[model samples]
Target: MAQEPLLRCSGMDKSFAGVPALRDVHMSVAAGEVRALIGQNGAGKSTLIKVLTGVYRRDAGQVEFAGNPVDFTSTQDAQRNGLATIYQEVNLVPYRSVAENICIGRARRRFGLIDWKAVNAEARERLAALDVHVDVTRPLVEYPIATQQMTAIARALSFDAKLVIMDEPTSSLAEREVATLLDVIRRLRDEGVAIVFVSHRLDELYAVCDTITVLRDGRTVADSPISELSRYDLVSTMLGRELTESERRGQHVGATATAAAPTVLEARDLRRAPVLNGSSVTLRRGEVVGLAGLLGSGRSETARALFGADPVTDGEIHRDGEPVRFASPQEAIRARIGFNSEDRKGEGIIPDLSVRENITLALLPRLLRRGIVDRGRQQEIVDRFIRRLDIKLAGPDQKISELSGGNQQKVLLARWLCTDPEVLILDEPTRGIDVGAKQEIQNLVRELADDGLSVLLISSELEELITDCDRVVVLRDGATVAELEGEDISEKSMLHAMAEGTAATGSRQPSGSREEDEVHD
Candidate 1:
């Protein structure tokens, strides 16, 4: 007799504000199997997860658990039914001890008094079963993000959950931490637990997932065993493209720099406690330097330090052979340094502002005369970038939130470009955007570099970074591990750096090795 699926969904449909977020989506998970749910941003992956977890109700669909039809009215209802979800950002009380975090609402008690000793002991046992060692008595925030993630997993497993849904679990983990997580996941699968893993890291997906379910524009495009799909094919399916070898190779015509360009910006021993540790790199005129690493590898931290978005506790930044200090983003801007943050919605864009207002935001002072707005000058700059970047919107007057993700990103780029910056620090520039838009942005980046603008590009897409960057700097645990230039930049090399935490031959020497690296907790 064939065993039934642990969880299954059919004809699932969901919408928000009349916008179809998901349609006719189907997914199934079997006991002891690891399934990966993957898609580009806004492809309805999150929506499907929310629907499955009862965070959002489905307009139409059938959910079955162990051959029994079920409808969960709330997340608690789903939890009660043996389904558990761990978000990308672990949600737990920071002040609470790890034991309390793991068994908060369901703590064991005697005479209605919570048993703290018993709770910690049980929590310790659960973590031990997962091959994780941690001090359960300490506050959850006392551990590194990776350890906290493991604690969350321990909590879910302790609940006797038959199925676990992890969304971007490794997004904030280091290389060693990611390995620990992969091991924990495998152990869970061996114990007959079903897992749904969601992540943007293709390497991580291929490493741990047994099967893959691809969603595109809110629809299930394909579902199959991992061995049945190639990386190129999977990407094409997710992107809805008939990409050629050249396209897959990312060979777009754009700016290519030579080795002799003068270095415009340099960082020596850049440090931010608990995130970046003595990370340093340099950007030259007409060059695109890429920061490559897994999540929590300090890629964003380095960018922040360089752009003065975060305070640099240690290290020195020199521009044009002169020491420069940027106390804030405003000071950085005054020095012709521009930064496009990774969190576009939260940090990059102002939703209520018009396109024109956002684009000319950084250049307002230059466009102002005697404290009055120079409307004509602002319009001219906005119009130029809008056309040049091919930003699609009603007009410069359109609200930024009304535009698509790609267009919103373009507006952000325009925002920085209007500053006429000598150095541009772009973090995850193409994230949450469409394929065509991503390519366009890449081409624009190349074009700008060709026009003598120095750029520091940070992206999680290894292939994109390898192809577009003139040189690639790989970071591990907040420090530069390798610098690949010319022929050294390849997907294989980058993967090796991320996996083995080793510097490549001829690559720039990292400050230290994995063993010498300090653990945050």
Candidate 2:
């Protein structure tokens, strides 16, 4: 006998503020199948998932879960109906114990009271299956971010779920932990649990997914078996670009410099207590250096420490071959250093301000005349950057919040570039933007490097770093784990060194050039 599909959705239509996010989308998954929902940022994957999960009431669609029609008005209702979702940011209580988080509201009962021992035992048993055997009674916040996410995964899967939706599940997990996660996903698939996996990592999707669904510009473009599509085809479909393999490889058509290039900035033994420990890096003039690591791996911390946005308890920093120590961002700026934070909404944008205002926000001091502001110079700077970066907007006076995510990021980049910085530290510059925007940013970064600007690039997508960077410094648990350059910067070798809890260790050599050092973490 044929088994009914665990979940199905047909003609799903969703919109926000009159903008169509999902257009007549149809998707389905049978029991025991792993389906991948993939697309560039802003491609409506999250919107469709939300519609299916009842996080948003669908404008038009038919959704069936576990052989029953459902219009889930709430996530709780969806969970009760055997549909569970695990988001990238864990939705667990930080102060609660891991066991409590996993078994809460579904606790074992005895004589009208919760069975504490049974609850802990069940939670432990489930987490143990995923190879995470932490102290179940300890507060969830006590563990690292990766461990907490694993706990959240265990809790979601333990909800008697017939259909599970994992949104960027491995974003916070290290490569080794990512391997364990794939094993758990395979076990669930074999056990007939329908899984909807959403991730940007193409390598991972090809490895674990049975079916592929590609979305572009808020429309369903392709839906087929994973075997029917190549990695190139999938990316091309998502991007609508017929880029050659070399172009896709990001071989960097930007600046070229020999080993004769000078060192613009260097950090050695960087220590910011619990977050950054003994991390070292060198930024050569006219080069892009990628900082590679999983979540909580000190990638962002290293950027912040180098930029003096965070306190550096111990480290020797040199700028232009001269010893220096930055007390704050002001000092870093004085030294011609720029930083673009990952949290764009909070740290980068001033929502109510116009595009022109946001771009010139950092240049206020330079644009002053006799203790008063100079709007003319500010507007001139804004016009140059907007035109140069090809920022799409109605006008410079338009509210920054009204622009797309990509444009907002460009505004932030312009803000730093206006300072004429010698070195730029970008943390997740391409994150949450569409592929077109991502490509533009990459090209711009390379162009700047070619013009003798040094860049410290951080991105979760290994391909982005591999394509754009001259050297990559791998971090693990708040320390430098490996340094790869030239032929050593392949995805396979990176995943090996980024493997969690391994003896991976390496450092940048004295010449500040990539070729000299080799280590395995």
For lDDT, the strongest prediction is: 1
Would you list the clashing residue pairs of candidate 2? 255-450, 504-521, 505-521
What is candidate 1's lDDT per residue for 372-472, written digit by digit as tens?
89999889999999998999999899999999999999999999998899999999999889999999999899989888899999997777887788888
Best by TM-score: 1
lDDT of 2 by residue, 278-299 (tens): 6788889888999986555688
Give the TM-score (vs. native) of candidate 1. Answer: 0.71
Model 2 TM-score, 2 decimals: 0.66
**Which stretch of 10 consecutive residues in model 2 shows the poorest summed lDDT?**
512-521
Give TM-scores for every candidate, taking all chains together and pairing residue i with residue i: 0.71, 0.66
RMSD of each candidate?
6.3, 7.5
Reference-based lDDT, residue 178, model 2? 78
Error of 1 at 490 (Å): 13
lDDT of 1 at 498: 59
